[model samples]
Target: MSHIPYVPASTRYDEIPYRHCGTSGLQLPVIALGLWHNFGDDRPFQTQRDIVRRAFDRGIFHFDLANNYGPPAGSAEENFGRILAKDLAPFRHEIIISTKAGWNMWDGPHGFGGSRKYLLTSLDESLQRLGTDHVDIFYHHRPDPDTPVEESMLALHHAVTSGKALYAGISSYSAEATKEAAAIMRDLGTPLAIHQPSYSMLNRWIEEGTPSLLEAAQEEGMGVIGFSAMAQGMLTDKYLGGIPDDSRLASGKVNKDFFTDEALGHVRALNDIAAERGQSLAQMAVAWVLRDQGASLTTALIGASSTSQIDEAVGAAQNLTFTPAELAAIDEHAVDSGINQWWGVTASR
Candidate 1:
């Protein structure tokens, strides 16, 4: 049998600096690897294994997963669970593992949403799928209008209090909802640890009220991690030319009907700004999201299909410095296409 690629025991773990998530004491790599697309059932197991190994070698200590990330739903977790059983189990203590449950899972009402039953059951299934006793962070995937906010927070609070999760967070919640949830979680004594929201060069909706939300989180010693920091690869050079064959846009998972001529034109303009910054579109995009000068902004949740693509994205950390003039130029040219209206901060606006 071919030997597993030699993962050097002395792999430099200091390549990527660990930043605290929000105000919490838990530290994560500045860039975290997410298994949203590439860890599915259709993908090769070896390829996925390599990606996870490479990430750990490079000091990306955080791995983000969700219950419904795979095409068959729950497949990503199962696949990751296998990796954990074989390779990651030895290093589990050194890693920060996170998972979420907010979107639809099965056909019925019990399969999804942020209800107490769904949250509890989903976590159990996710734990089984991930083959882990406890996750570093468990998040409510999205806001649930049908359930009372207290119910959702209590479920998350229960996860931490019971030792199922070390910390808790809420993903894609409105600034108002985040405040309410944080207050309740604080009251429960578990306290919210982080807030995961979509923030990118193209999407600035979170900025509308995120500052205040962040301020409160800091007061409570929680952290904030931004996802969709690259706007689903829209801010990358991969789309500069007509949608390439290997790009995610070409993948059947992404609906092509939405990317009309207008969206393409907008992408072209944003690419020009990247060129001016002397950075790849993806690099510039990640840097844009990490612009919180003194405040403790934790990490960026980035997804990649291939090892090379992730390498390019992680290269963004090298050029985190941005001048005021560059920031202004980016704001002037980078405009959202209203594609993310469903995002909590922009849903009503």
Candidate 2:
């Protein structure tokens, strides 16, 4: 295909739904785009552009990325930056772009943790790769066990104060850490804007403390947005007939051994219930994560490999409700995937 000029849909906002992220006055789309899987050097640039273009055309204006999101660290950000510069630059203010640090991006002592040096240096490199002056949300990807929590939080504060990020959020932080970090930010006068954790019916570690997390976030006015709602695509129908060649399981992102026989049985039962709900397994799975909006969840982060996947995932925003019986049906099979990276985390409820 030739390099085609992109023209975004004019009625895009009419296609998707948006909700407030915590209490910070930022309304994010019900479904946000994640650049974790694709948008790498391994993928074609035009295909990456098309997926992002399609997502924006459907009203998904929030794009999420982390510094180490590629097979080779930093490729995803480099690719997305190219797309942003070439295509979305004109509409930059209309979108909420978020990126994170605290992962293994480069070799050496200062490259992997939440020190001021690492966080600030990483954001600068990310901005250069993203081809932007600042991001909408800058996150600390995880808590550094060796670094003092105050130091990490301080680095995050600097991002906002220095104008490198409009707001600060944390990912994979426990409820206790969120409380402490929220307080640190509060004292600094830079209240947290959101929390990003991987959540799905299949991995509910975050669910264990959601009510309390939301309560605290509400009291402090912070919002929560969840990622991995599809469990790397296991929640979708593609695995019902055994893994396809192109599936994430085959690609090794989702562990094939994680879905044991027992897990498969639960998946099939859940798929049947999804069918009854008039949704694809993927749609119901995505919607299930957002169905508990009363908990103050701002959005569900979705990742797509193609334009068609983007179209299908957007359907999650359409039917966001469920009955008592439907909720009961889902619980019967919503077992923990055991592959959730944030499992075993506990916080006061």
- Best lDDT goes to which candidate? 2
Worst 10 residues of 1 by lDDT: 340-349
- Model 1 agreement with the true structure over 1-349: per-residue lDDT tens digits: 9746345246537666668766567888888888888899889998998888777777787999999988689999999998888788878898899999989998898787778999988999999999888999999998878788888888999999889999999888777777778888888988888888777766766666545555655665777788888777777777667788877778765656646677677777767877887888888888778776555468888987777766776677877888888877777766776656346631121
Candidate 2 Cα misplacement greater than 4 A, ranges: 1-5, 209-211, 343-349
Superposed on all Cα atoms, the candidates' RMSDs to the truth, in angstroms, are 2.6, 2.2
Task: Flag clash pairs in model 1.
Answer: 21-223, 22-223, 22-224, 23-222, 23-223
**Model 2 C-alpha RMSD to native:** 2.2
Cα lDDT of candidate 1 equals: 0.79
Per-residue lDDT tens digits for candidate 2, residues 288-333, read 8888646747888998989999999998778989999999989989
Report how far residue 327 has shifted in candidate 2, in Å. Answer: 0.1
Q: Each model's TM-score, in the order given?
A: 0.92, 0.95
Clashing pairs in 2: 22-222, 22-223
